[model samples]
Target chain A: MTTAADSTVQSAPVRPFAQALKDAQTRITTHMDARLGGDDALHAAMRYAVTGGKMLRGFLVLESARLHGVAEAATLEAALAIECIHAYSLVHDDLPCMDDDDLRRGQPTVHRKWDESMAVLAGDSLQTFAFELLADPRIGPHGLTLIRGLAQASGKDGMVSGQMLDIAAETATRPLDLEQITHLQNRKTGCLISWSATAGAVMAGADEAPLRRYADALGLAFQIADDILDVEGDAAKVGKAVRKDADAGKATFVSLLGLDAAKKRAKTLMEQACDALTPYGDAAETLKDTARFVISRDS
Target chain B: MTTAADSTVQSAPVRPFAQALKDAQTRITTHMDARLGGDDALHAAMRYAVTGGKMLRGFLVLESARLHGVAEAATLEAALAIECIHAYSLVHDDLPCMDDDDLRRGQPTVHRKWDESMAVLAGDSLQTFAFELLADPRIGPHGLTLIRGLAQASGKDGMVSGQMLDIAAETATRPLDLEQITHLQNRKTGCLISWSATAGAVMAGADEAPLRRYADALGLAFQIADDILDVEGDAAKVGKAVRKDADAGKATFVSLLGLDAAKKRAKTLMEQACDALTPYGDAAETLKDTARFVISRDS
Candidate 1:
């Protein structure tokens, strides 16, 4: 029996993954620039923080929204909101008090560019901006649901919780075991990805389970790929200090599972991710390409 | 002539300011304790950061809501939400990169109690939690309005913008002039207070002009009073360091206007605050009492 997914696959022409990703990045930046038009130093820093990222999470939002027939305007807002959140996390994580990285997205980090105080305020403002963007009336009736979901995915029990666990592990007497590492990664990176993937369904008021399953597998694959890149990729290609995780003796997937096994695991998970998108059939081809790119890209 | 304001004042029996303040404090704390039940370090720091404040903002929300006949349960959530935002600001402002205060509300600040990373995460979480609370269905149909208002009030253009100006002023060649200082104070502290006071009107879809007028006067008076307290308040009573602004040679109402003139100005503003609440009449007795307390409280 032909399913709705099969019909959608046949009817919807697939856009190239790279073009789709580029479109999301351009649209989100334009939207952000329009909203954050102040000439103040704070606005400048906020704009700086959100620039030059991969916009993969945002692409996920736009693509998923397209699959679910959510309005493009609302989807674009959600996409930009997630980008703000992602950028804020990066800014804070690069703080001297946290990871203390000097570089992000091939530029001096927010703190290094200005001062730590500016970085803190910029990050803080960006987080608030994310929620503000979601509260826009264009987001339709599901605005509150989207707001609550983003809060849950990024706040204490989700991204922040993951960050705390990672910090605690840094000083622990013993390295984290596989299970602990998985839990940490899930919280630290997985939660936001899951939220982004499932957001379209939430917006469309459709079932989110398939997207959730797709995201869970995809998020782990993404992280495992990150580990592989940390060990094997060039610093310039990765756009950050590679081998730092190993240098810090951090118990990443590669460290725990061995590089070869980790790569295999990421591959298997990427396949699982693609399989989970069967409901969207060929309409989800770009998403399938995204899953492949997550494991394959250097950055 | 009988007006709605006059009738409301006559019909609504006045509750004692202290008793109403205490009730708001109790309800907000109870709600917060229930919501923040996790035993993790992040939760612990969040709970700690929110504790021991005067709960003045929360009280303002509850009182404003009461005047408009908004549901008590929903009002309580907004009350707690504002408190969370207030506490988060305090926590972040006290970081080493910012104001660097060690003591807050007669207790060690979050960074001193835990570490900088934890403080950052906790503050970040609290901010997100504030938005999350406001997104609750319990907050009724005006939830989106409240969320948008809050984001506008506290984000880059509001509280954070004020903070940036204050920091910039610290290093400027000359102390801020009266006009510049007023602008800074308006953004830093005035915006949130205005949002809180007018929340009832927003929620009830009533006119917010009177409350906005009351809050504008009250917020300015509140800042002037803070300047006075900085000069005259004992550290013990104030619950934090006093006279730092003078020592640092930071421009303040007390410094610019002289202590006596500043006191006079605060008193005049307080009266203005009270007068603006005439529409609410006796129903606003507690709020008028609050206005009086703003310039009079030692802390």
Candidate 2:
């Protein structure tokens, strides 16, 4: 059942960005399956929720680890951990009380496929599992630092706060301005992205400033690309409903900045992201490709 | 604003269990307030969710830390962390899709007070906050071990799995037998309590066998007492609806064992819990009182 992407990644160090992404997807899914083996419903739902994603955050972790000379063994687990967090957020966000999406990754959302209670439990456990993975001794003495960083990046002050703001925005008197939207997206999506990209430096006990700068730009570009996709991409290719934000009259980069300007802005951020990696020289080619891919991908 | 119970605990070690519990509540609340200082709706909900519980788990953490000579500064955070986990569980469990509970601790549930989205986000953030608290350097180098332990105790194979089983049991063709009930309760309520009771040993890198044994008995006794309260206690005293289990025809400890037998079993377990604390002798008096309180208290 191995795909060409998997074989290519396994065969050589010089992988195309697509192949590397698929490779991360395969490795993380395999790792997650091994660790979460059981017949229980919650585990089954958890497995389902984590599967079928693009695994971009995971690729960032692996690539960053490779750049920092950290072992794949440790980074792979951290990669899986971030995916768990990502998947869990998606699960809860898809709940009826939240964004209320019926589809995710071209499949029924967790609540639609199973039940809301299962979705809640599965999401809850997946979050706990993320912390559990980071606490592994293989991550070395920096495990606490990583754990603390993640807790800050994803907790009340970070991702969740971003979500709260998004919900509040939906009911506000007017659409959010650009500054507010930037703040919200930074917390909602950018924080985890930054965390994933900088994890390698943290694990290596090296300076994380370079990766942080790269990630900050890269994350915003990725989100702008997402907004573009929502406006222009087909649902089939995008793997979820599109244009819903526009339909609901919700403000997004594409709406606030105009579609053409939004795309140009994404390109600028992508360049800034690549420039931030200048310290790593040609060794950061894969990351440069990743930055390019972020602005270009439809999904 | 200061109650007699709070005053008594601050003054001396010879304070009664009620005073000690109140002190734990006050201190943990203050600590949480200081840590989660934000006017954001999600933060507000998180603060509310963590408040008003009996603080029994906090007591277990503090008492066990004292027994192991761990400092209050360290254990207080650990205590607050456990409370966050406990509170998050309660908030989610009260969701309309889950237990559908309207009241908890004599107050409206999170979903009722705010909304389902707020409840979900608040509960979600609280879980993350627990790990954040544990990641504090004051907990010493054992922070990872404690984090890993908490994650395992509260994740898929532990509390979440138990909750899944409870949900499934609601529609089962046959009632769960005594063995099934024991296994379910062991995972459901027992895991976190065991973790709390043994946290001090984990923090000190000391042997945890005695505390584990005590927690096993005490956790079971606590569940039995809860069942007894469901059958015999008033709603005002219990702080939640009484006899809902009977109304729903749910099988519980009281339902299977009969009232008198259940009471006797709980008493025996209380005795066993105290017996396991013999190694600590007079220094274990508070914990022994805790075991007695578990089986005898109205709530």
lDDT of 1 by residue, B105-159 (tens): 9999999999999889999999999999999998999999999999999999999
Clashing pairs in 1: B9-B282
lDDT by residue for model 2 (B108-195), tens: 9999999999999999999999999999999997899999999999999899888988989899999999999998998899999999
When just chain B is superposed on the true chain B, each candidate scores a TM-score of: 0.94, 0.94
What does each candidate score in C-alpha RMSD?
5.1, 5.1
Q: Note the chain A TM-score of all models in turn.
A: 0.94, 0.94
- Model 2's CAPRI class is high
Stretches of candidate 1 off by over 4 Å are A1-15, B1-15
- Model 1 has a DockQ score of 0.82
The lDDT values for all models are 0.89, 0.89
Superposed Cα deviation of residue A288, candidate 2 (Å):
0.9
Question: Estimated TM-score per prediction?
Answer: 0.95, 0.95
Worst 10 residues of 2 chain B by lDDT: B1-10
Candidate 2, pairs of clashing residues: none
